[model samples]
Target: MQLTVFFDPKFLAIMSNRLQNKKSHKILFLDNTLDVGGQEKLLYDFLSRIDRGRFDAVICCLKRGGYLKDAFKKLGFGFYEELLSHKYDALAYRKVSRILAKEKVDLIHSFIHPNTVFFSHMAMLTRSVKAWVLAIHASGSPAGGRLIGRFQKLFLSRVSRYVALADAHKRYLVDVEGLPEKKIDVINNGVDVDKFHPGPSDPDFKKGLGISEGEQVVTTVASLNRRKRIDLLLQSASIVLEKRRHVRFLIVGGGPERNRLEHLTRYFGIEKNVTFTGIRDDTPAILRASDLFVLASMRGTETFPLVLLEAMASGLPVVSTDVGSVRELVVDGESAIVVPPENAEALAQAIEILLTNEEKARVFGMKGREVAVERFTLDQMSIRMERLYEHVLSRSRRAD
Candidate 1:
């Protein structure tokens, strides 16, 4: 009798030696943009930390490029922006296929949904392109939006590998879409622990934001989207201010919901207490300035929020609703506080508890920082990803 086991301390290293002995495999990382979103940030961190000697990597953006392209250029990584218009853009598809073949890209790793279809075809279309891996960032549940949405749901079955950011997302693909469970893998998005670690509260940072001395600042850094529930935070601000007037609500990040949510703040008459700072790049500094962090997202699909780790790293206790992987990341009254979704009153109360109790909040923040440093660091995530890539490649090699 025999048992199968897995251990590969030298997989990447062996691959690197193979590359030196022969030809190296190239990677084409396809995404919608190089923006400051979760998936984009994950890519950026990977672009920095992955074992560069093991494989050659180039980041290719589908449409409008963002700040990250410039960052990549500065780091001397290949950056290309080609607007695909839509997934089926024939001209864009041809261009991508040509690049993959001409560049000798071994695999195409897609970060968005449309790219899955585009690249999967490019693999067949190019005739020699090998592997295609798709990372499902959203919940991936079937929504009855339009004809296009229906087609997207239908297309999910044909992707090479369906990678979920959380177990919930994997379950959605398997249970909701009937995708094979064996084809799905859970890879939680990781954070840059060094840059986002628990820094000392910057007094100057608070002063720059016009926050007076000793006045606590509670903040939420997320897109001003309906899913993120920025309006709920505004309402919670109204409730929190009525009780604790010394605190300020700093709303970071921007989106289509900005003007409407700002109006909602005015409607609630808490505009004085709420500050809408648009899509801030200085998020780590802002988190350092904050006393507590709140993620009031109404969406159950948010598997792992990078902001929660950022908050923890900045030494700020978190007050987020019990949704998605929030339960996985935070412990009630221990590492962080969790409330029910859409309950602004409860949300505000949780924020108030963290605010009113300074010592407990600091302890929670410290514990959260510990968890982040130990478990969720960028290095750990990069190594995990390197292994995943190797696993997919090894399977592909075996199949061939």
Candidate 2:
């Protein structure tokens, strides 16, 4: 018997080259707008902290200018804007396809609706891109009503991977959209703990908001939309004030519903107690000045709210509605006080409980901070995403 050992020379050479020259993977991110929202903020955070040696990032938005445009440019990443005037623009789609091919993007990660639908199809059209990842940040039907919702379900099947902001979102994708459960992955939004840690309250911030020295400030940072239920929050503020008149409410965000919400404050006769600080840039400072955080969102609108994490990281106890995986984010009695949505009385009661017990509130804040640092940090999220990219790339290569 003759012992023969044979190895393919081409295979050996390819392996040697791969080890010697590790090529950095190029990733492209697509979004409808770079507005100052949770999804956009998370994208900025991921790109800013992602490992530069292993991956390069590029961003393209459907709408041209947004608050985060300058921030992305400061990160030394290329940014492109392809404005889509209509719902279905064939020219815009072609332009995006060309961009993906020209950039040699290995992976295309798209967030939210039309971006997810558009880029996934574009990846198929380009043929050069290895994978397309779709991320769903909100847990509800697609925007633009039912027809667009149907289109989303139809297009979502074409993407190579799906990421949900929370498990509740994953279930929605499966049950409502008929997506396979195995195709979806749940990755909660994370915050930069170091940037949002507990610290001395900013006196200037409080002064600007007209918060008195003895008044306890309750702050909420969210877009002022009907879905956010700012009306209910106003009612809750009125309820809280009836018992404790020294508390103040700070509503920080700008949207079409601002006028209505402001009117509701007047209607409830809590105008003196409620301050509408429309769209401030210094969120961490505002959160630090706050003694408590509340989010009274409507049911089924939220997935995993980033503001809650920011508040937790800021060492403030939260009182949020039990909507879309919020219970998963906060332990009812331990980290936050979870209450039912659309119930102003319940919301006010939860706020009063925290306000009455200073020691218990302090303990909850400390525990929340610990949870945020351990479970939801920028570094941890980046590492998980890096691994996910590598896994997708490996699978694509094997298929090739």
- The most accurate candidate by TM-score is 2
- Per-candidate clashes, comma-separated: 1, 0
lDDT of 2: 0.83
Locate the minimum summed-lDDT window of 10 residues in model 1: 140-149
lDDT of 2 by residue, 78-112 (tens): 78885576766746776677777788889988875
**What C-alpha lDDT values do all the predictions have?**
0.76, 0.83
Clashing pairs in 2: none
- Give a tens-digit lDDT track for model 1, residues 1-400: 8999875644566566776785555778877777778878778778776665576787777776786678777756567786587656747776676677677787778855555465555564445556777776765322322212555555454456767766776776677656689988877677787788667766777777767776789899887778898888888888888878788889888889999998998898877778888877788888888889999887553768888988887777999988767776776778998988889999988888988989999999999988888777788778877777787777778878
Off by over 4 Å in 2: 1-20, 141-148
Q: With candidate 1 superimposed using the best TM-score fit, by how many Å does residue 120's alpha carbon deviate from the native?
A: 2.8
